[model samples]
Target chain A: MPAVIADGLVKSFGDTEALRGVSFEIERASVLCVLGPNGAGKTTAVRILTTLLRPDAGRAVVDGIDVVADPRGARARIGLTGQYAAVDERLTGFENLQLVGRLFHMRTAQARSRARELLERFSLTDAGDRAVKGYSGGMRRRLDIAMSLIADPSVLFLDEPTTGLDPRSRLQMWDVIDGLVADGTTLLLTTQYLDEAERLADDIVVIDNGSVIARGTATQLKSASGGDRVEVTVSDRDDVDRVPVVLAGSLQAGVEPVLDHAARQATLPMSSTDHVVPRVVRSLDEAGIDVVDVVVRRPTLDDVFLQLTGHRAENDTDADDDDSTSAAVPEGAAR
Target chain B: MTATATPTRSGPVPSDRHVVPTGATWLARDTWTEATRHLTATRRNPELLVFATIQPIMFVVLFVYVFGGAIQIPGFASYEQFVVPGIFAQTIVFGSAFTGIGIAEDMSKGFIDRLRSLPMYPSAVLLGRTFSDLLRNIFTFFIMLIVGLFVGFRLEGGLVDAALATLLLLAFAYAFSWIQALIGLSVKSVETANSAGFMWMFPLTFISSAFVDPSTMPGWLQPVAEHNPFTIVTNATRALYNGYDPGMDVVWSLVWAAGITVVFAALSFRKFTSNSK
Candidate 1:
């Protein structure tokens, strides 16, 4: 059986329908990332799955227990880390974890030992005894995740786990999430970052305006959107205008390239990049248009989102490089 | 940090669905856990404890000397004898406002979401909050009592009467904590909770017989003061402290405490469970 299943979940707050018939399933010991922009019902969906909010009309089951029918039973099997780090600012990190352990009904000695182990695992041993108010944002978030894992829950939910972290801290958080999945724990993660979904999710569900717009693996989604692309940057700003015409003349088709006038760059969406680059470069050289750089690039998740939704995924700020001309990142064994 | 530390999930799971206690045992355990969390936080922040004590001491001092001679009660010899008990009642009631403020802060910080997602008893958050605030009220009560004695106030009743009065005051304040918990959950921000929690309390304490006799108030406001619940509690405590028979006021005060606690605790828990935000 699937470890987690959300079926026809519909929730509304007064006049606003936050989620409308959203559904997904996560296989055991695999990660599913619910990708969306702000106000796209990502949090509402997560809240419903974690049993924090009851769905108005639908059902969610975690580890074979119905969330709506038996929330406490579902709660026992799942742990949640919300968008904000929910650690008590006034309590020490160790105290925070230990307190959650006690609430889970662990013995005092067992709670203490588990707290110590989690603190060490999260690289928070030194800061365990100090109040969380003094810790950095990353430390607080790590402790927050640790609190949720106190009982070694079979299913864990991290809602926008690294939404507002520095790039360095975000990388660190990704590594920690990778380690958890390595232990064969079923994970359901929600994030707005497309790269985050690409990096961690075994399967991706993209939602917008409270509905699932697309769902598949990263490669499948990218391929569905389009194929490879060729980007050319000219040395002179004036050369940008003539480059697209030259490319159409060389490729022997009516090719129209998207141009960035300020950057003197033109990008053409192509079905195949094989042998297209040399033809374009030779054409540009014959046309005497001073070329700065030319390269072929794979379609990114950003392109997929733009094609699916007709708008770029919210802020795609960090994924900006991947959209403009970046080589495919090497796949790591960790995630 | 090394990501290679094999995750703890490799070990046997320690606790799960079957281990969770049910009914009263579950409620008591989770309430105490939450209470301990609040109390430990209070202990670590000495300034919070210090400020909680300071306000009551200030009220005791200000009322005893500044308004002591000017205001007089019909049955009391000195205003110190009457106003000291009133101050105690007022201080504890005022202390209850923190229950709302703390809950509002927790809600804003998303700590309530964390607790709600847990498998623990649903009402424990409210119970724990009020319980810890009640403990703080007790501590503040003693400080005000000491400060009252230092300023020439004396208790004429037996030790048991005095203890009973203290319990009544604490019980009444505990009920108010539930009301504050509801307000805290209703308000959007800590700033709003701070003002909303104490906005009606000032009039509730003053319009009653807290600092003076109801007979001394304007004729139009006398009846409001006479029937006010705060007045009943203050009258019960004041009579017991001054060695007078508390009469039906004691019974009525206990009734009010029990009624308010039952009604508001239920309301607060319902609000807590259904509060989507």
Candidate 2:
């Protein structure tokens, strides 16, 4: 049976329809990632399902409890972590968790022991006694997630859990989420990062303007839209021609090799990169092509989204790039 | 802190570890939990605790010394004795504004949303807030008493009467505090809540017989002051603490307290449980 089911959920704020007939379901113990840009009803859907906001129209059930009819009952079976870290800044991390446990109706001793155990599990034991305001963003996020688990909720809704974090912290949070999946917790996450959804989700639901646009496994979505492309960076600008030439014969039929002189790079589009990659590298080495880098660039979520939405995933970003331009991320993440 | 408990797919929930007590048990437990959070915050921020005592002490000293020489009352022994109950009323009304400001701040901080998402009692937030503020008031009342003693303010009645007066004062303050909770929940910003709280409270306290007998006021304001709840409370408190005439005003004061609590607590609880804000 599905752990979560939302049929025809609808909500509005004044004139703005935040959600319009939104619907989806998630199997037990599996991860379903809700993908959408900011203000695309991702948070609204999560809020409705977690019993924080009541929908104007629809029926939602979690762990067999109706969200509309019995929100308090549904709340008992679900844990929610919002985009913002919702833990109190004035209280110590341990105090925050202890209060939540007590609110969950645990005995004093049980609450304390559970608080201690969670702090340790989240690697917050050393800093648990310190006020949450003094914690780093990553530590606060971890604590926020830890607080949600105090009652062992059957379903967890994490809305943009790693947003605004440095890449390193994002990786750390991902590892923690991965562990939750391993423990068989049904996870429902919402994020704008296609890579995050692709990496973490068992299934992905794409929503835009309060409606589901597409839904599928990450690999299937990628294959249905476009296949992988191989990126090769030649050390010498003059050898860029040899780069594509050596890769041409190994490429599949109907697939063409493209060369970029400015960046001294070559790209080959293919149905699959597994067999063609080794052949291209061997042929390049045989030709003394002097390659700086060789990477299999699977069609990014950006491409799949463009294929589906008829526009790039980001509203302001351009669609075209050198077939395999590396994501030009800044050196260090500021937030 | 995402992990509350590991999800168990099938079975009766563990009675000892994960039982979610409902109704009154849930309310009492959650209110106590939230109250402890507020108390812990106060301990972590000693400045707030110090200010709670210092503000009341300052009020008692300033009124008894600087203003005492200028004011006179016909029947009382001294102006300090006459104004002590008055000042107590003003201090508590002022303290009640914290209820509004605290809720506004919590709403702005997204803390209320988190609490609402939980399986806890709906009105526990307001109860916890009042609980903590009540504790703060009790502590400050003692500080004011010590300061009152040092400034020629005497206890002219029995010890039990003094205790009863304190409880009565707190009861009125708690009722007033619920109105502030309503204001706080209705406002958007904490700044607006704080400013609006004091703006309305100032007239209610000052227009009453808190610092001066209503008889000394202008003809029109005198009648208004005579019937004001603050005037009623101060008169009841003065009678209980100073061995004065125990008129129907004491009964009226309790009625006012109960009336304010029932109307405002119901309104505040309704606003709190609604989906708005």
TM-score against native, each model: 0.91, 0.86
C-alpha lDDT (0 to 100) for residue B20 of candidate 2: 53
Per-residue alpha-carbon lDDT of candidate 1 for residues A1-335, written as tens digits (9 for 90 to 100): 99999999899999999989999999999999998877889999999988888899888999899988888888877899999999999999999999988777676667888899999999999999999999998999899999999888878999999878877788899999999999887898998766788889999998887899999997787667665667788999998888877766433233235688777888776656668878888889999998889877655545666779877655444544444433332221112
| DockQ values, each candidate | 0.43, 0.34
Identify the leading candidate in terms of TM-score.
Answer: 1
Where is model 1 more than 4 Å wrong at Cα? Answer: A227-231, A248-256, A270-286, A292-302, A314-335, B1-19
Docking class of 2: acceptable
Candidate 1 similarity to native, TM-score: 0.91
lDDT of 2 by residue, A1-335 (tens): 79999899999999999999999999999999998767779999998898888888998889898888887778777888999889899999999998887777666666788899889989999999999999999999999999998777899999999888988899999999999999899999998776788889999998888888899998877676566777788889999877656666656565456678888877666655667667777888999888788877765555566667866555223324424334411122113
Reference-based lDDT, each prediction: 0.85, 0.82
